[model samples]
Target chain A: MTTTTAPVRRPTDESQVSVGIAMVFLLLMAGYFLLPIYWLVVNATKSQRDLVTTNGFWFGEFQLGQNLADLFARDDGVFLRWALNSLLYAGLGAGIGTVLAAMAGYGIAKFDFRGRELLFGFALGGVLVPATALALPLFLMFAGVGLTNTFWSVFLPSIVSPFGVYLSRVYSATIPEEVLEAARVDGAGELRIFFTISVRILTPALVTVFLFQFVAVWNNFLLPLVMLQDSTLYPLTYGLFSWQSQVSRYPELQTLTIVGSLVSVIPLIITFLGLQRFWRAGLTAGSGK
Target chain B: MTQLWRRRTLAALAVAPLVALAACGGASTEPADGAAPGSADCAPTGGPVNLSFTSWVPGVEEAVTLWNQQNPDIQVKVNDVPAGNAGTYSNLFNQLKAGTAPDLSQVEYDSLSSFRLQNGLVDIAACEGVTDAQAKFVDWTWSQVQLGDDGVYAVPQDTGPMALYYRKDLFDAAGIAPPTTWDEYYQAAKTLAAADPAVKITHFPQQDANWFTGLLWQNQANLFDISGDQLSVTVDSPESRQVAEYWQKMIDEQLVATNLQGFSPDLYAAWNSGTVATWVSAAWGYSTIRDNAPDTSGKWAVAPMPQWTAGAKNAGNWGGSTTAVFAGTEHPAEAAKFALWLNTDPASLEILNKEGGLYPASSDAQSLPALSTGVEYYGGEQIFDVFKAASGEVDTDFTWGPTMTDTYRFLSDGFTAALNGQGTLTDALTAAQTQSVDSLKAQGITVGG
Candidate 1:
């Protein structure tokens, strides 16, 4: 390929026009993605009165602090409690579950063993089943074992991430088996090799798995709604729903629900922004290979 | 990536403290105080009972709290589920299949036939506080909770008698009096629209099956004729189509504003602001209007629902629920007793009404001076009298076929489709009826031949 034959266009009128169009399109995409979050933030700052009176997307009086204070005070700061429960469920479930999925995926991808394809296929099939369909069976199984309403009832189910396993396997497959065999030749055990070698190479995939699991568990409602009867154990989604259901009766909750919705979204935004690099990297790695 | 990992770790570390905080806010609601004498000792000998009572309203909290206080030995827990009539009841049936059935739960009077057919509930007619209390309720209301074989599976909650709530100021602004007939109501709405396009005379979500349900009930159209275990929807009937077409006309003429269903928060605000002129709602909606639309106080007043004909029944029930004991409860006696007291006891009703703003279901309790007292919110309009008179005429005998939820949802969707001119009224009705019958049969609900 000669440099002279290559089409070179820099700062031409057509190029500039295309760039302008691209900028506008990108801005629109960004707006589309951010609109709901923006509305939530702006809406959170308004009192119930302002929420109804003013345009939805624009800022009203800056009552965010008051709304948060009221939100925390509602039914004795139950919203905070729900947030805590969600964090516990999603955090531990995602953190440990991601590491396990990484190890399992690496084993399936790098190791040549009987039933490896079967195991991967099984995990893929598991992902195909809707979470709601499993809720009842999960409840009955937990009820039989006296695990219903306990934290473990939700945590145990969240720990098994089939999608996480699939991604990890695909990720670890790129880390050539030669690297692992070399580590083994150096007297590193399988567990040690998996931890100190494969995991570092698969960090991008691991982070993606963790974030997916974290969001899945955090947003999960039906499972926890069916499994946990004790209000204290409810995650943020279920807790918010409980508060929302009563809003028809108690209009005071309208502001609190909005505020609660806003606060719940903040952690997710931080998580996404922080971990988005890993997600983007994982996608690049997959497509690049 | 490291930041994401740090966030996850931080979120994980924060979980314990957050859960502890949520645990602090637990309402730990138990039954209300005081049970009828000897009702406590009626427990059947068994292992420590773990029965459940499911209800749709916070009103049942008073009863459950009372039971927990008075009868701790039996130990009945309550699940105040957060869904509407169809959603919650359907969940109950699904829970039964899942073998996680509550000991007691609420069932709609119209939906009672389906519940009865399933035989999933216990016969509480034989329980204490129920057999003798039947006569005290309005006979029609009592018959609603009664299943076949004389089994009373549910305790009656508040009745949903319909009435017209209009902003008097808005009406005066439009230079029209309160409407007494359907034609006059449309005329008033048209005049109100001309006076100010923003001031909608009535705001009903044409897409919501609730409008259809209320209209059909008001016109006394039996949705289905139930024979033995069979069910059939009468949507092809003149009255059913009449209600559908009336709503279609209202939409086409732009007299009624289109909003999403189930207590539209925006329209509620509009109503308070005097932008929405009139709303046809049940007795319970009064509480919502009074609470949410505080600024519209003396500006709002109750009137009879506009009639289709001069002598036709002028009201229809919109939303009402009942409390039933699930058969899985270990404290059946205590649960049933509590359910009864909550539904029937005047003191409990008084507390619920005062605190929760629930209209009383008990016949005697409705006569309390407080029930008739003028509300300062409505400019001292004594609406209790209006609600009380209308409650008597609200049809109490609409068939809640097994496909009740599906029918309502399909009809609601079809109504929207028709109103949007996507389909004709006949096409919409036929489609809705077909979908409803299919859904009912799928649920194993035998449609009447």
Candidate 2:
């Protein structure tokens, strides 16, 4: 490999200017993305009076510790309950969703079945439909069954991510049929072969599907808004939105909403950062082949 | 092939619910005649019964807790439903249609007609002492809870009689007294703007249609008139045009700020920094100002809203909500009693005033020691007395239209465009008038111009 390697060329002077401009553009984009989060952090550390009076980007009296204390202590620590509800909804919802999508995708890709294309087409249609359009109808059905305003109402809809199945199908098709045939030749059962061989090959793709569904479930607001009435079952997004609408009457909720927003972002950040390696590995998996 | 067919069938089974559910839309289980499944007796039974109430008022839980402790037999479970008027109404409407509504809901005076027309509220006229307690509340407020002379749908919990709150320091610096008439208000705006370039006499928030409606009401502009079932829309009448034209002139001259949305962060900042001199607000605004602009304490004072004609004492309401019993409640009697108790009982009303910061709609409750005392936040001023006097002057004949939500949305869009200098305020009012007529017609209601 070393003997046949090609030499890389250095950037020309004109290209260097273009590269510099591109770097500047990227830095500006990064600042655009981060300014709101920066504002949130700076404002969350302020007293209720200071929040309105001070500049949004600058530090106030450094009340982050106190704000955090108040956030957890308000309404008998309801924020903590909302956070836990969010984790339960997104965490379990994404986990089960990924497994179901992977199995359905693998079955559709490998099996020579009747109506396979039709089923895939149906799921693709689901991918195109916006979730909000389905919320009201779903709410009515669940209400009919007396299942609404419960945890299952939010979780069940969250687990049915059609886009995840579509992504899994595209990725699973890249696995070679020869590998499965070889496993069959070795007398391994189809289930055993899938568990030991296909699952390993599909790990990177599955991780990508998991992250997408996780974020979608984490940020879902309208479904929970329409479905759940009990505040105890509220996910973070709906809970914060509920608080925000009442700011006109309960002005003190302004600080709580700001601080709660700042706190809600941390778990998502950790989730993305921790799984970033898998995201990259998944993107680059088929490049070598 | 058989296995393949089985797999295909399983996949089809998964999608069946989506189609079926969409087709089976929700329907109201109760009859339109208000014959719900509950005993009509208004007396509260001495048994443990849990009642649910939905409201956005903060610290309402404290009032509920007080009631819960006193009457353990009839416990009220407070649901902190946190959307303001429109959102709460829509949510309650949905639940009512589904036959799963809470026992009681908070309905604003402006939106009460919509709820009553939809049959979302029960006739509480026969509830214990409801008709007799009508004499306890302000006449206009009591009238709002009734449909003509026979239908009583809600209990008046609070009133939002409009008032003028001004920064005394800014007024003194500009050497102008609080204007008691519309002409004086216009002159004071000019004087205040000339004294300080950064200061405006007040802000007319285009996004707040309720506040604009109050101004129109004070001018005696009957935008909507209901005679029997025939609704007439005259939103662009001469009286309304007069009020709109005067505001347009002020906005064109830049004597008042029209860009700030009410209850927005910018408005809060403006109040805190003393850039805006006066706030034309309702009685409920006292708590809003005190909580948001704490440092501005002792610099503010309350007075009656200025009049259209010199020395006229006409006033109008901006925002206030009532506790209405749902028709589908399982415990109608208990729910009715709780609604009455929450609004009229002196002890419960005291908790609402001191903790929840609500201005009382009941005349007797207005004299509660908590409200009668001078407030330190308003510079030792008996602010409630000013609001009390203003409340007494509101036009009892003035009524809210049944399609207020849609009408307000159209008006807000028009006014917001006008405020941004895209068009004149009169033109916006005309557009809003046409839109309101069309929307009401679309609802199959008779409309006349």
Count clashing pairs, candidate 2: 0
The alpha-carbon lDDT assigned to residue A66 of candidate 1 equals: 91
For candidate 1, give the lDDT of residue A261.
Answer: 90
Scored by lDDT, model 2 comes in at 0.79
Tens-place lDDT per residue, model 1, A1-289, is: 2222223545456666666676788899999998988888899898876776677889977989999898887645667888899889998999989988887888888878999899899999989987866776676678778787789999999988999999998878789878888998999999998889888778888888999999999899878877765566888888778767767666666788888898887788889899998778866876786
Q: How big is the positional error of residue A91 in model 2, measured in Å on the Cα after superposition?
A: 1.0
TM-score of chain A of each: 0.91, 0.94
Each predicted complex: what DockQ? 0.15, 0.31
lDDT of 1 at B88: 50
Error of 1 at B104 (Å): 1.5
What's candidate 1's i-RMS value?
7.0
Q: Residue B42 CA error for candidate 1 (Å)?
A: 8.9
TM-score for candidate 1? 0.84
RMSD of each: 9.2, 6.3
Query: Between which residue pairs do clashes occur in model 2?
Result: none
